[model samples]
Target: MSLDGHTAVPPESSIPPMPGFPPRAGIPTQHAAPPGGTPGFDVTGWVSAKRHRTPPAIFSLGPEPRPSDPKTLADDAIPGWKLILRAALNFLVALEIFMWLTGGALVWALGFVWPALIKAAGQEEFWATTLLNLLYVPVALILVFVFGRMGRWKAVWRRYGSPAWSRLRGVAVPTAGPVRGPVEPVDVWGPLRVVADPGTLALLDAETAQGLVGDVDHQRLLGALERVRQEPERLAALLGAVREHGAVACAHPSGARDLPGRSLAHDLLSRQLRLGAAENVPKNPAGYRGADIALDPLLLGTSLLAVGPAGSGKTTRLTRPVAEALCLQALTGSAVVVVVGAADADLGPAAWYDVVVAPGDPQAGYGLDLFGGAAHADEAAARLADALLPDELALRTESARLALQQIVGPFESGYGRLPGVRELVLLLRGEEQAWAGLLAAVRGSGMLDRHQHELAQRERMHGLADDPGTLLADRLALLDRPVFAGCFNPSAGDRAPLPLFALRALDHPLRVRIALPDHSHPEAARILARLAVGQFLHAAASRADRSLFAGLVVDDASAAVDTHAVRGLQRLRAANAGAVLGLRTLVDLPESLRAPLFGAVGGRMAFPGLAPWDGKLFEEAWGTVWVDERDVTRSLDTSGGVVRRSFRGMRALLEGERAQTESVTTRKVERRRWSASDLAQVLPRGHAVVSLTSVDGTQVPPLLVRLP
Candidate 1:
């Protein structure tokens, strides 16, 4: 099957423009807001396209506004029919009044002049009647303008004319002067010519294009173009494959356009993926409501924290679209994305990813390297220990890591490679012969301390009840089950083993999906998730190239979140990397980590049905914004003679409100952007409250969003 789960055709017959994958019904396709219009408003969509510009291509983001178009004005101040009705009503009223004022005089004058006009013209009544009918047209028009609101046409056109026309055209049209020229072509190199479409070409500067073509490191250049299309992000790999196979030519396996997956919007030009629409709520900025709520690397680079109860659409609404966008960006040669979730989670189709690491599944395409492909045994041990040790064993973690290092280091030194899970577990168990063999190997390899004191110390610890090696062995044995026999064994199987360490030196965009076996092995899955997180952090920080955006999306990050992962998240922004972590609630984590995790991520989202405590984290993270506070006071009017008071009481009884003095006060004061209660209870189903911070320091205050 193709990357998008479509049936894959043979390479020879795959080059065809296929129909778009039919999306599930009732899910609205997202479109860019017509220039000068709100997100959901598109006059062009409502009108005839034949009279305007051509319909946009499937991947195009429709048209943008021109210089002459009114930027702040939207189309049609009033409905066209309503405007006409108003104008016609005014004309009829004016005509009735005119007749009323003229009364019998107008009729008398016309009757008196009828014969005189006929005699002067020397024509029949029919001819005279025709002449009068012709004169009425201009007179009626004059009356309509004088009395009717028909003059509003000028003002309406003045405000909405340019935008309405531009939206209809699908391209900006100049109000004055000759039409704009066609987009210039970029002169680039031969290799890049294969995939550069006209629109993509137009975006390229000649000098930059030339520079990129001449770049000695084609792989590096490919990485730089991630998120922006030049050629398929896999061009370098394709070239290498062709050279290795000595093939004369190769056709695109998946055709020009990416195979369709589930997504509401993919606006590559703006680098934003629309998730939903910002609801028109009081908490949201007036301008933001009805505008597309989207995600891009800029906002995602600071990391995103999503909290929602089960079935709140965290997976369906947020993770799916975000992962799809990153996958599409990866296709453009612009970004690398790693998506983690339960095996059955509908993150995306396996065909969309470069590697699908489904642990516990025998047929999984890739095996996860337990050591994260680390060359240093100590580095591998630290990462593995983090995954193996539970939060309750925080104090035991250091000793466990040390215990793992002792075994892993000696095994690597003796065998010249990292040990698989079973091998590490066997060493950790301190079996008589296994321990003796490892000690002999270490001594033979000269890895032992002078006088063999280190080996002696290890021996002494292994016989004690408090030895951390036993605990470490028990934890590592979780994955040694028959179900995971071939998994995490990079050197044992013919299957490809994916290592997070390779992410640091990537030349082209790589998409990886790690499906944790959540059902059958929940604990093991969490360990794997923690392993992935720890390695991803190390790789992102050590990356040699920062041009391509690196992203991770964890569909359920409950037990996977720990202190180390939180710290890693805080550093992702500076590394040009980010993560999207979804959680059921803050209570899933340790109470102490909740506030710190909130502080670590720059973006936070609270979905409908969130717990109050989870909502509180979002509330604190968003802080407060200034709003106008209004106060009104009413005092009874009771100062007069007895008869006056009785008269006021009678008036109050009749009016339903007592006569009173009123005082009003308005002041600016601080208020939480979104109170905890609002986030928990007031949020509507299929909606979420989200706040975002871009890498460049732009902040989008918390706003309620209606999911697409």
Candidate 2:
């Protein structure tokens, strides 16, 4: 037996026994043996012997079956005459009903007022009324006919339009058996049938010739095939005739002489041929790794992540891709590429990137340098006190002056007073030398120390004056452009609050990359992450319509970040900004940041990680298919060799694998890579993975680069 045109023989066990066969006590009974034979027959051995004895050969079924003409099949299936009659009947019935209603109402009213009408008709007024009433019949009849035709037309079109549209649209439909019209139209007969004229056949053949062989008029072709299937011999003859005519037409040069109607069939056939050829044509150009590596022009418009370990060639990947994108954009005159780095030393030369941002560069000033200013301010204040008060009377100065002296003591111990202090005092006192007397009195009275102390305390307390000069310089720099500020330490202390510069520079979306060491101090990293996220959110809120002035790249992010910063990052996305984060282990991700960041990122790129936990985290964060265990294994190989040498002998062993006495086999285990790539292609160093959160979702990939 065959199923769907394929051989399908049943297994021996599936074959049923004969109806009259008796059951055996122990042995399983399959088919009943031929008369008088043993009940249990060994068919397998027989089959095997036959298989060994015979060689398989390709079998040819006869020539392909010819198909019936599509026109004849359609004519046989459709009840054309019945459809026309139904339409005409519907029209008459509707007209009759309309006439009855209007004519009946008019007659009813006339009956009651006939005497009055007759009296009025003797005059001209009644005649006008009669004329108007008579006009209603024809108008009513017209409306009925129009409405009835529309209703029937809708129904008829619905039935025919589906197949016609599918055919025109090139959609495939199944062909099972002979086509048939509506069952209700069984008694109906068709009137429209034309004789098989050469001209008619030529026209149809020409049209069929125009279309490519595989370019089916889906519904029409399916219907035609179905009809032909019902009568094989008739279909075969029709196809043979069509083929013969087509060959003759092709062979005769004179046949191509443009016969007006005859060309239609050829045109259609030609179209079908072209469409078929097109369908078979390959769309993609040929290439190998180069093709795979070629950057998509579309991807240039989107953000990318290049990630690997320190020495894993992340920089190479990023530089080339980014440079390519920038070059492409420049060539196309589309957009400018701006790269902001922590410092000029970090990013290298300006020529390295389209728009390079380095620390201290005026064009990339993010905000005031809090620490730099504090150091400068301490020096200036100390110099001022040293010049105003004499050393001999310094102890006797006022409480405020003494306090100021103590504040300046640290600066004096660190760096000696500046010579400009005397010049400054002279300016304040309005005398070159006479001011020395006032200074002496104030120093002896302790007032100078007291004043200085108070001023120093105030500067430190305000955080602005401690490094006023540096602060001024940084703020002045920030006024120029956006900066990628790096806060090495983030805490509540004076230096800890340095991220405020990022908050201030939010107006200018600068790209900020923060690197934190992976050690015991996770809390510090968490705090910094929160600060970065908050700064981004604040910026996004301020510039709702513009792209975020800055983004945060936190390497080795911890759960602590989600505690406060994740909320901010989410808000930034809502406002149309972008944020990319990095994490080493998903096992440690804070739930709050995990869900939102993972959910919102537009794309995800995952690298090999330690266990199912990593995969699960990504799956939970972003709906991605779990990579095959084998593929993951192939992608991540971190095992290393250890060699030990002794006086007697030397031995080498592979890490993470145990040797057995008889054989070697490894226990299946989740693999992990030290580093991974993010969507943006920014590689992280050490045993780090890059996680990016954009308007899309979070992606974590193992770094392919080596760690420092």
Candidate 3:
């Protein structure tokens, strides 16, 4: 099976050659709009000859099957069609001899028209030929001009013009002019050769045809070649017969004959979250625009989702470019980034960031403050409780919440700040009080109610005194790892302290990296990521000024659920912050969280590797799309159970009344403007069906964007 999941047909999968070409069914076509066009792909042998496959030899076709010796047709009793036709041909041969002699008598038989034949041959004069050429030139011009007005010109040429003729002849038509223009530049990825039949060519507008004609990057070059509902017939009619590079296109077009790549850095709009200009920039189907990474400064408040399986190139194509662009922004002092990714993931231009926290990096000494910013004791306790607990620990939420409030209140009452994670861990363990001030503050400031409250829960919690702490301790173990030694508790280790909320106050632009080693301790990484995000949200919520732009990025979000996920996903907009959350599959999210989490993000990218259920999410996300449907019926005539279709086909039929098996078939067929299953499992690599909310709140349809 190829990338599109069809083993039978290749590109030009849909509108197969109007009735007389090779069979191609259930193939994929590039119909772009986007939010992007589906990038070109061929996992099967249809686009090109497969090296491992040897096509069967054609032994029974053409006129070569004619001939039989008729000595019983072939020297013996084994008879054939020749045995029956030989006698019939004998009489025809006699009649042919009589007519052969009559051919020379054509001049005598039509003496009256002899002069007319000679006149056409130019036997009259050179003057006569010259006169006709001059007169006919003017007459032919007039005839062409008159016919051009009727639409007959367009309709007729659609069937017989360059595009159509090229298809009919089974060859690609050269697009360059006969006379040379300036030398054309070549693209680095090399040239792409596409062979599309005329019907497919008919559906393409000139600009699009030009993009397909030129050699560009796979993302930009092939993305512009997508076909949609308006040209369903033409899309299916086209076939990509020749493929030598990463891209493929139409074999013929009626419009712009040459396609050229655009310059991204200089020609693009010079503002927020912009990447490269779109391929064939002006998107058709009107309102479905392209380019502009859809990462608006105002809208980052809503968020983004980039998903695909490992090796699907989400990092290279989608993540990398966006990261580099954001890095550039950070360098300009406009935004702050808190990016958490796999340890080895490359974030461009390291100098742009002020902080880099790599787990297991002993020398860096970085860990979030854990409870850095809280308006009061209750809020801090609530946030900590949520972050430290998981859904599996349902019984612990309220108890842990009450216990955390007790722990933080005493620490804050004494030290004037919330306790660090390491301190919280020790206090939960009931260790001897190392800080005499905590004991002193608790006893002296105790109003009668405070003392009674602390004692009341002690007996009620006695039986489960260590349960909640132990469970949370396991998840927080990474904080004490050698890499984060000095970072977790300022007093516990001799190294410099690194804090999560420290950057929230920075007036200048800053880049922050939180490295999670997915390749090694994925679970630990996930838990840490969740804690950091929850802290960031708390920090964002308390800001006196929400003017500063901030982004929190989590790659592989499906791995774990942090405390702030629900509010952070849906309500971060008020904090003037946006998030980019990456997930491999939606199934990883709990059922209760899935719906709201999806609804919260204003922009989405559904890449390959999603299951049908996942694809259905996109369908719902994209909502309904109106598509053109064609019902095709195919019939197979079986003569004596041997299927055949020809003038003499009746000869093979069983003569008597008989029972026979039925032979015929027919059938029926979203946001990628395809079925959900196709978008989920069959979407080619490095591509996504994107639905983004424009600044105006216009809900654009999901568009195919070949990732760059």
Candidate 4:
């Protein structure tokens, strides 16, 4: 990159641009900076290949077994001496305010009465007043100590003090605007802070920390200091590191979304973090205001749900950024990103990921074994059947599941292996001589009675186009399509290896894309999606040990959600996995899954076009709290002349009646924290209400965010 941050790349680049983020103007196709150019420990050993660095602490070379128990770090606490000093300082301030008020009142009273008293006392009175004034200085000094500071003033102030004054509008007063320069993402001195575990902090390699430092010349150093106004954490680090290394160090932190596109790759590839601020808003520190648009991964037992209209920026703004971040994570050995419906182009570039499995792209040559993934043959069969099940066959889910198990059971016994799509289709159609062998094996194995009923039912349905041929053709159309012709056709010749369900892949840091044909064959796309999602969930749970952070990014989730997804929704986090699911609204989900799915995700962003029922789901999932607000109203009216109105009022009073002349009213009102209607249609374009969950399971108030 040049000092101005424009990237360099070759013209005939194979790397594709992200969906919404086509290569920006002047952003040449390019490769990322070398691993040594970034601040992170090497994680090359963790991945299948030495693609990148930045390994997890426990994942590095160590005989120490990974600890299963969670660790907690104690919060920073104010020392007793500091607390005492704070109290003393507060007391002195109160004493000063009291003395000023008392002095002002006494001066005003004396000025009023001095002339009358002086006249009454004459010359002797004047002398006496002069003597009294001479004594005032000593008296006031003693009173200042006795009544203001060392007396019951503290108690008195406490009894009448309005703590709300600081919070009241027009009293404490807000800043004219956001600070002109940078502010902390979160304050070091803020009351609420999550103490990061020592292990987490130790992940930072001090030797390579300099890579995180950027353009630290005198001018840049001054510029960075000018921007870092209140981040004590960063300030201390820079100062300490500079002292330790005998070199001044500083990093440019962008205040807005003005960072060059390549800068994103720097943060991601650095391995210190998976996300960086794509765009930023100015800070308002007094209140928890402004946007924290950091691209945080939904892993570590958390997930993200972004709901918005079809054309809304949920994909461009939310999903794309997250997918990009996960791709970086996958490179750094921190995450395994399994994205469905998106190819190298849909996300960022193929080089960003270690693997790209495009099922429909014939050139990609990635095939999926229809039944080899699950720990049990039963589950594998069930998931494949569910994916192949027709949308209209709602009542036949069980029957389809049974038919799959029967076919799978006989074939596995006969062939001693799970069948690919082609082989399974041939066997189910009863055209292959292998079917006779499979049936004989099932009967010999004494499973024939259990499978006969379902097999008969399937045969009866096979005669109909809606059940058998449609199911076959729906997927077969994708297989037959010009784009995916030879890739999935095992019967045609040789087959590429299908690695979708490999358990070892879970712990392996790699980016895999399950690209589907969504536009041409929607049902076929849905079928592939359901199967992929289910397998990811089941494979995640089957991991022998918790190691890598796995993530699934589904951009068109409305079509993919199924029974397995619902079952895996809440459990994925525990399995050391996360998913970013996108859809129009909760209305698209089944009623039973709606609430659970919403509750399972740790992050939710509701953009415009939220329906009423969807709003209710968000409302209930986010829950509600009673907030008190003053409801003020005013009225203006023409009334009778002053005397006439007064006479009528007096007469009514004498007659024990009421007169109406009220114009203003103020009353305290309680309402829901965020009403259903607030999300349904009230939010403006580019604005959304979000609910974020902390690692400790704390629910934050629905945050109002302006999408960047």
Candidate 5:
């Protein structure tokens, strides 16, 4: 419950259960311990409380923890005078009780009760003296016990007087455990039973129920329930279809849960992946202050570029969560996710992906398609050139593209296929035997006559001293080493290489993970990363079917953000696709491409320990917002009395400042959303400053967020 007198409803509990399907006996339910403890604890009750259970919702982290809002010092404050007064009052009350029980009893006994006792007894003086003395000691002792520091009277007096200790203590009370119920398994089928026919629900068994609960998306389940409620007749057939096939019948290609383990938290019904919580700062937008910082493909489709240094929580916090969300979305048949990272990077469990392209791993199960499955020679040439050309040689990108096209076009035309990495390198070197064989083959096929003009241009460029082919060949040779033998070969005869363009052809969700050869071939690894990114951008843009949300997650995009890749990133939102590019620093990219890369992506994240220079890019990209500025000034009190003025003059003469003067002024001013220094120095560990833009163009200003 909130302070507004209305209950703060949980998202899942907001949906009204129609009817039917009471919780089964073995269905798990969690319970939370009641708040606070007595002076003496209930050891048995506390220990017996359920400590752990299954998660309540499939997408949530067990339950929301208690908000640790700091308590105000004023709430528990007691004035020094009140403290003294309360102690004095308790002493007085205890003395009064002691006096009444001892002295007052003596008087009462003498006046009434003792008169009758004296008449009945013989020695009145002795009896009265002994009884009165005994009463004094016993009464004083009893009163002392009752009014002691840890006694009931002390607590009662404190509650009754100026320093009410119990009420003050209540302000900072701690709970024994979370104030929630047992973790009930997410009731996926309960809603279905209510809307659908009883016989339809009867078709579901324990296996199917568990499958639906774990694998099927909650939103898809709700949509199905809504459809069945509207047309009751459809329930039977729908249930019957899935009963034999299980929950995967409605899921994407592979209906089973892909990841062996989950680390980050999620809430899939709203299609939002929890990243962190926005900080409560005045500069933050009204609705976003202290809110859950989350994003879906809609926000990501605009593309997200995260800049941070190593160990800045970029991979563990941002990249992993986004990849996991997309993978989960893939299970629902709504998205295609491709994660590219170093071999050792923990993006997710390998089992989560259908294809794992480990280039140099001897035990690798799959290989990469260098051409991105491009059928056209020109398309493959452009993608390859973007990948191989270094940022220094970016000026010759066009020449390199055309240069590769000249070789790749003729080879494919003559040999009926594109050249592999080793073969392409040999051809790019302009070896006599390689060119002569190709020329003869093209002539035999009559390609030489049809493409004579293109071949003539290729020969003329090949003879130049500064030909782009030499630069491309040097870069291409990096991948043709013995370490990468049979890596880029499509016809390796053992495993079929997965292509980037495969995303376009899939109706169901597809997950692909490409692990680069980072250790043995560091430079080659960067080239591979860049190649995969460039190919992904082209393949995503050219997709004939854009129904599935296409997402690319690059754990370390050190060499991927070229001018062409940046331009391609800008157009992804319209294609219903997105890319998450993580970089250790902006220096990993060309200085010229930095600003353009920031501008291309709609979502920008600056993680902790960011360099001041890198933060400036984010600062400039985020721009400024209107804020209230305060100014304070102080001046001498010249209009006061003679004594006050003399004291002020003396103080001013001694200290070189006026003692009694003050002023404050406030006005609206424009300030940077996050200053470079603040982003560099003030950002906390496991936190980042992010600005988001949704697919529909809903903009969220840069705000500090504490990563979950």
Candidate 6:
């Protein structure tokens, strides 16, 4: 079977018989009839022939035993002979008691009077009896001590005499003989062993192992050797297993239908390996031969790189996997999906997604129009009121006085009529008298004309002002709706106001995705990405238990992230937040961003592209084993349509050769296509590869789904 165009090698047919072992003589070889058995020939001679069997054994009798002399028996007494004598004496005492009981008359009399005797004796007699009982206690204790010592001696003798016990103790003591000289204490410690051996250890110690373990290095080396010896096969098997499983595909687009089956095999292998399963060796399923793509779920736990030239289905693949995640989130009620693009028009409304806020054209000033209108009106109203109120009174004293009366009357009617207006009139009359007296000194000065000119200008300003009622109406209108402010030119001087309108509007948990095309711009992308991240953080902080966001998707994420920002996302991952970031090519990313971004991402998907750098980046990001330079060169040489030869003392020569044809080659190049079945098995469209690192630490393979 073949997977991803790689053929599987078949199993060996027959294992060769072991060498150097000859067939035993007289061992008859039996063969079955070919297909059908013919009439059997009589084989009475073969049946009657002596079979190879061992002869039966016959029992033999030995010489009779000799009688032991009494003197010899006494000298070589059995162990615990003294204890046996004591037991015999105790038994005789028990027999005496039984004999007395059987005699009947005396025993019956003792039983009848014993309790009455104690009662008759009274308190003083009882005390004397207790004293006598205490005397007997010491004697009984002495006897118990003597017996315990005897039992210990008997146990020691029994243990030494038992052959099985001697084997366990690793000593063979003679059962019957004059005692040998005192036994030396056995050294119970087993043979000392070292893995690298003493010579190798000394060499290593002289070289690399100098600082490894310091003074106790020898002990450490021994311990390590013990561990290695205990499980040498396990370590070897682990290394061999991962090597056989090979590279795992983390993610690949569903549109590349040719890749999923191969990708799935890789994914399965990776998962099995991660679980420490020895049986996860790669095997091509019979039906899946010729698979074009292979995926490994373990690879998804790392980062993924999707690479292709423009219009080569890179974005299509990236988005497809993301869409599938959204669908899954919807199904599980785990997340809400939001699609943010360069413009609102870029994302057509779909049922699975919600457009919280759409990106607008920065050049059109729509943001300013929406947010700045009310501010402008308020400023103008205040300016007009400041200029007109005082001047209107001076220019038309009578009209102004009448208007003031109307204003004051309304307040008076609302409250009680106030004496303040009357006092004000009296003060103005007194001021007039004082002004008349100073008129001669002020007559030739320009101050009076300047006041008159200012008064006249103010009168015109007041004439242009809207009624106070109208001013309130306009302010009320401006305050009615929320406003969205677009990006402002930060370079504009202090005169330019900060974007308070947008900031205030964002206070509510509204969605705002900023697309920063010029990531290279001084701080544009950083600012936007920061703002987006801030919103998430703010929402998370404000909510009681997190889970405040619908969802945030960052497309063309390369522009929005830097090293520091990626680190921030890594921290956010602990908060159960979901994010999807799309990149054009993983190799093109700045190292600062690449390291942290890859470290943070829980899943990845890749699309096919023609770039050696892409393969290198993928290998690094996914932790794929690097192909040996020699092996790569050999493969490439075979790949080229030329045969090279070298003769002794002659220059190498090349001969033209045709390339081997493939099933799906176009113009002598392989064509990549993903089918519907492949998509069904993995990620869907608009979502290239759907790799997910589940909460339990399992990496789910990239699901290929077609985007609607």
Which predicted model would earn the best lDDT? 5
Residue-wise lDDT of candidate 1 within 1-708, one digit each (tens)? 132322222333322211112212211112111111012222212121221111111112322212222222222335666555554555566687566534544434565767565454345577765675565567566665655433344445544675587557645421111122233333323334455443333322332333221111222233333423444534444344333321111211122124243343755434567667765456776646545567888889999999999999999899988898887676555677888999999998876776678888877756677776254778888988988988888778888888887777777776677787767777777788777877777778887664265456666787589998888888888887878755675433434443323333332355778899999999899888888887887778667667668888999998789888999898889989999999998888988888899888988999999888777777778889898897989999889999999988855543335889889999999999888898888889988888888887877778787887
| lDDT by candidate, in order shown | 0.64, 0.31, 0.48, 0.51, 0.66, 0.31
RMSD of 4: 16.3
Candidate 5 ranges beyond 4 A from true positions:
1-198, 205-212, 215-240, 373-375, 490-508, 632-663
Model 6: lDDT equals 0.31
Residue 28 lDDT in model 5?
Answer: 12
Best-first order by lDDT: 5, 1, 4, 3, 6, 2
Better of 3 and 5 by lDDT: 5
TM-score (all chains, Cα) for each model:
0.67, 0.26, 0.56, 0.56, 0.68, 0.29
Q: What tens-digit string does per-residue lDDT give for candidate 4 at 297-317?
A: 433346778888787677766
Badly placed stretches (over 4 Å) of model 6 are 1-309, 320-333, 344-346, 350-356, 362-530, 537-543, 547-550, 624-692, 700-708
lDDT (10s digit) by residue, model 5, range 1-708: 111111112211222111111122211111211111122222222222233211111112222322222221221244545545545655677787777766556556665755754443335577766665675787677656744541233334533652464345433312122112323334446676665455654434444433323423333444445545555555554465445433322333332333456543554454567777766555456455445667777789999999898899998998888898888777555677889999999898876776678887887765566875364888888888889988888888888999899888888888887787767876787777877888887898878877677777777777589888878889999987765655675421324443223322333356778898798888899898888888888878877677778899999997778888998898899988999999999987788888888889999999989999998998899898887787888765688699978866754543224675688899999988899999999888888888888888878778777787
- List, residue by residue over 92-172, the lDDT tens digit for candidate 6: 544455455445543345446575544443344876456534644564555445543433333334334553654565433
| Total backbone collisions, model 2 | 84
User: What local lDDT score does residue 25 receive in model 6, on the 0 to 100 scale?
Assistant: 25
Which of the two, 3 or 6, has more TM-score? 3
Q: List the residue pairs that clash in candidate 1.
A: 3-351, 3-352, 53-169, 226-333, 226-334, 227-334
Looking at model 2, residue 240 earns an lDDT score of 43
- Give the clashing residue pairs of candidate 4, or none: 9-29
lDDT (Cα, tens digit) per residue for candidate 2, span 1-708: 111111111222222211111122211112211111111222111111211100100001101112333333333344655544555565665667667756566545555767566346446596756765676767676765565443343444544665587557642321111111212212000110122333424533443334321111211222233334456664444334333432121110011111111110111111100000000001111111001111222222112332223343333233322333332222111212233222311222332222222232334423222221123444334322322232232343243233334334433332333212222222222342523433454466555654555434534433333333222223223222222223221211222212223233332212223332223333333333333344444444455334222333333334224433444544554454444344444546544345555543433334332344444544444333322242222222224444322311211111111322233344444332321223223322232232222233322222121211
What lDDT is reached at residue 123 by model 2? 64
